[model samples]
Target: MNLSFKKPSVDTCSKCDRINMKLKYAFVDQATNLKTLKEHQEAFKAAYEEKKANKQLAQSSEVVAVITFDLQQCLPTTYLQTNVAFYKRQLWTFNLTIHDLKTNKAFCYMWPECEGNRGANDIASCLYDFIINQLPNLHPNAKKLIMFSDSCFGQNKNSIVTTMLMLVTRLSPQLQFIEHKFLVPGHTHMEADTDHALIERIYTCQEIGTN
Candidate 1:
């Protein structure tokens, strides 16, 4: 058979779903909405393709670095299967992974609920600190830094993170250009996800202790 079955994705794009729903009904006008859907999906595909191309470029060139970053789902500290321990208060652990396509390295920043809440400030700070430490190590010719992440406004798309990126570019002499882009919402599975999976597997072996 020429045709293959593609199962519906678990992560459905909200914008696509809304447009699809409208297209399903005869009453709703489809002209402009259909065009919008076409453009949106095309943009999504283009972004993914551009990231892939940039990754290849980064691997070969010293001037460019492509980094994909994402926050792992909160893991509860003192995790226990026992019925008594399940109800007890457990500190939430937050982890943010910044994976460089050029070096194939994942830098993780972690903190428990006691020290800080996982917010824009904390995320921006972690990224800024990482860049500061690693800036000296970057190649003398390095100039461009490309970043990929999901469009979670609170974490990635907000002004705080944007300002941090701006500050980094201004402060670092070698690093001049920084481009932060969001992946298609539903298709944002990234290298950072692998880090989360590995951490989760290890975390299950023993409880992750408090901060």
Candidate 2:
């Protein structure tokens, strides 16, 4: 297998794009946009660096556990690569993936469309159960948690999830604190993404049907 390692630097950030566009076409105040763009990029780099440092610390010490979670793209309930399948309606399946940076272990909280929707409540419930019930048992020595995710206003970044985490920290005696951080909006490629890629590989190769 001829493989060459490549660093992924996808330019998909909306802020970056908008600023670049304004600069390119001379739309806005050039000085202001340039300063804003520089600040945004610096913040992006700083976030990545902080996550990196936290991961190393979590791996070395048991006091901290670093985790990143993401909701995978909805999967078709019954799928076949054919024209007939395209015309037919399909049930949707949702999965939220949580990956531990220290252990490289991933946990998937999944459900069918009939069972649940992937909204703020759905996400918060899953997280609540995991943090309150499972996380401590899994990482007994982890007293602090550092979590990373995208800045989706509806899901992870909203008031509901924030309040849930605040409550979780208070309710769970094992946890001293929880720190949640958002990765750069468009550049949130994470460890869970690799887990999803493996799942996708197997998913696409096989057929799924309701019995």
Each candidate's clash count: 0, 0
Off by over 4 Å in 2: 4-11, 208-211
TM-score of 2: 0.88
TM-score of every candidate: 0.82, 0.88
Please, what are the lDDT tens digits per residue for candidate 1 over residues 174-204? 8889999899786787888887778887888
Cα distance off (Å), candidate 2, residue 101: 0.6
Clashing pairs in 2: none
RMSD of each: 4.8, 3.4
Q: Which candidate achieves the best lDDT against the true structure?
A: 2
Distance (Å) between predicted and true CA of 136, model 2? 2.1
Q: What shift in Å separates residue 136 of candidate 1 from its native position after superposition?
A: 3.4
The Cα error of candidate 2 at residue 150, in Å, is: 0.9
